[model samples]
Target chain A: MAVQITTQEAVKKIRDKSSVMIGGFLGAAVPLKMIDEIATAGIKELTVISIGAGYRGGGVDIGKLVLNKQISKYVTSHVGTDPNLIKQIVNQEVELELSPMGTFVERIRAGGAGLGAVVTPVGMGTEVEEMAEKIIVDDKPYLLFKPIRADVAVIKAHRCDPLGNLQYKGMSNTSPVMATAADIVIVEVDEIVEVGAIACENIGTPGIFVDYIVKGHSYQERKNVYEELWIATNKL
Target chain B: MSRDYIAKRIAKEFRDGMYVNLGIGIPTESANYIPAGTEVFLQTENGGLMFGPKPERGESDPDLANAGAEPITMLPGGAVFDVATSFAMIRGGHIDMTVVGALEVDQAGSIASWKIPGKLLTGMGGAMDLLYGCKRVIVAMTHTDKHGNSKIRKRCTLPLTAAAVVDMIITDKAVFRVAEDGLYLEELAAAVTVAEIERLTEATIMNIGEWQESEMS
Candidate 1:
């Protein structure tokens, strides 16, 4: 059934201390509005798992979460620009599990596929091999990266049909696999059309993975009385 | 004669027809020193790029790139591919050499190349994958900052990029190959003496290779 809900309602399904797998490499397909809503909703002690965008890509990293203080733990491959989370982890205020970048992507792929584990040649001797379960094969030990299951997967889509079939531009697949892996997949698209309007070949993610679709809220139009002061001050 | 003594150390490793991946920051500078007429191919991690020397002004391909997300142009014979395939070249041990920037190198030759506690630098680009998966890795860097802290240290306190993947260390002072036992200092500039390096380093470094002055200007 198609669900019509606010971003806060979707985040409400995620309780405190839940191990939620988020989809994003950076801001590329990262659900920022949902993350912002979750941050504002007052949930705490949540663990987020995801990747990085080199510079200005993913907003899913700890910057916004640290600003909102919503994330308690992070199991991610890269948290590049967010210094607060790194400081918190260094200070032991937040728990962190840093994985290899490629392996982090594969971990999500394995999780959504329901595989118990997948073997890889990555992180054999490095710090990433120090997972919860470490095993050896052929006299060489391999760490067991368990399946990642999320309570909700918040994603960004370029376009969505009424039935929720999604389309994406090329090279925008940070959380594409996770889009189908989560229990509740909430997508925010720029535009929506009627069912059967989208070509089947272009429907990268099927409608079944989708539970709800919402157009993103636009804050571009809002003007403040102290807009210049606010803009300059906030720029800091 | 200059701080660019590090460049000559990296330049020595270049070979004809070598497929190389350059990391962000100073590692990218190695591209400027590749001997002319050498068929060295450059590969980036994000999306597409072709291998070549830098393109002419106003003729560079904007789509060509490295992991740093810089706008790059492909050469005449460059091939474009996806990150999945490019990383395959890295992970599958296809690339000949990979040069990355490092934050710290411990006595054990372990590297902590990513994440500074007080800095806003975001993300480790292809360094981990390239390091573990590459056949060999060269860390190109400034030996020490103006503050006089030896980046080659007892142990790294910052977050690690890869524990022990570096093959050679190229600093402005000298070029040292990291071995399982200890560091093997290969070459040094005339301005910076061996005594200065020994006094600076906290680890036990050995002189393994003969001294050779760099030929690059």
Candidate 2:
């Protein structure tokens, strides 16, 4: 069973420099409130791994984090649409470690599974391989990609029972495996109900994967409150 | 010389089997003359490759795109791959060449590939990776804007893509190679005179004497 916590408590639990995997690709089905909490906490040097979708978050989701100066480095797939990331990287304002989207997912999954490393042909003879270690297997050289792990996982869910069973409502998912790998799995949901209220089978991630549940605050009149969050966070 | 003339001249530097990443605008036009069957592979930072010709209307694949976020069809022998890996290829030093346009280039070969002084722009797409990754870089642009300010200057006053990665400069006025010695003039557009080209240039350019005419495919 998971404890029911307010959004602030959920945010408070995450320490500084903690690695967090925030869900959603291109902003769909993302955990806006939890992200807001993390941004507001003024956590320094936190590593955020996500698909760059500041545009769909009504702007890039992590761009606000970058703008707010909450995060120090990023392990992301794309930041093309995010103007702030572009400017920062161009200006050398932040440290960015970029990986391919598929490779990024594989790294998260491989980390959770306790795999030491995976061989990929994606970055061969390229700059990504410049950081790579080459190994010979059967007389052919292969690039060994390292495993990635997170300290905390901030995940979004459509519904969560008191037991912490979760249901994801969206087209696709990103960095879900980091939930199982991280030490603390904090879940933010649109709605929270009783245990067993959600069908046992429909839950995408079982309750065992979650450590805490924070319910999302809905403001009917002030739509897209997440956008206002950056303005507030930047003041901090 | 002009931007198109420079682009056509820069197209001559393409060598066989060179792994290349092209930037947007006039530099993207160099795809038209990739040595017919040079075995060159084009990478776009956004996702896919359109290494060959601009496909006919219906022949394009909506899913396959260039670094510029435009729809494209791959050249023959092209394969589909993930975007991150594509960039890894760029960042990993797998590319042999990068040909892109420049907003500004200083005498020392420092480049500005992103942001016009006052306007918000689309920004760099693999330009940083291409700048630092590829072994050879060629910039294609006119000698000056229609407004007549040098794109080639003493220093780049704009947001630079990467430090100093330029190996060659192909301007509408002439073809200049960035040698250890200096900017050496290799070829000239027929209409432009060597003395006129030298007067307009910002740096001490080497007139490697004259070379052949350029035909942009």
Candidate number with greatest DockQ: 1
Candidate 2 residue-wise lDDT, B131-206, digit = tens: 7667788888878876877777767777666556688888777777776656777776787776677568767654
After TM-score superposition, the amount by which residue A202's alpha carbon in candidate 1 deviates from its true location, in angstroms, is 4.7
Worst 10 residues of 1 chain B by lDDT: B208-217
Q: How far does residue B113 in candidate 2 sit from its true spot (Å)?
A: 1.9
**Cα displacement (Å) at residue B194, model 1:** 5.0
Q: How big is the RMSD of model 2?
A: 10.3
| C-alpha RMSD over true interface residues, each candidate | 8.1, 11.4
Q: Can you give the lDDT of residue A46 in candidate 2?
A: 79
Q: Which stretches of candidate 2 lie over 4 Å from their true place?
A: A1-236, B1-3, B47-62, B116-125, B206-217
User: Weakest 10 consecutive residues, lDDT, candidate 2 chain A?
Assistant: A227-236
For model 1 chain A, where is the 10-residue window of minimal lDDT?
A: A221-230
For model 1 the local lDDT of residue A5 reads 69
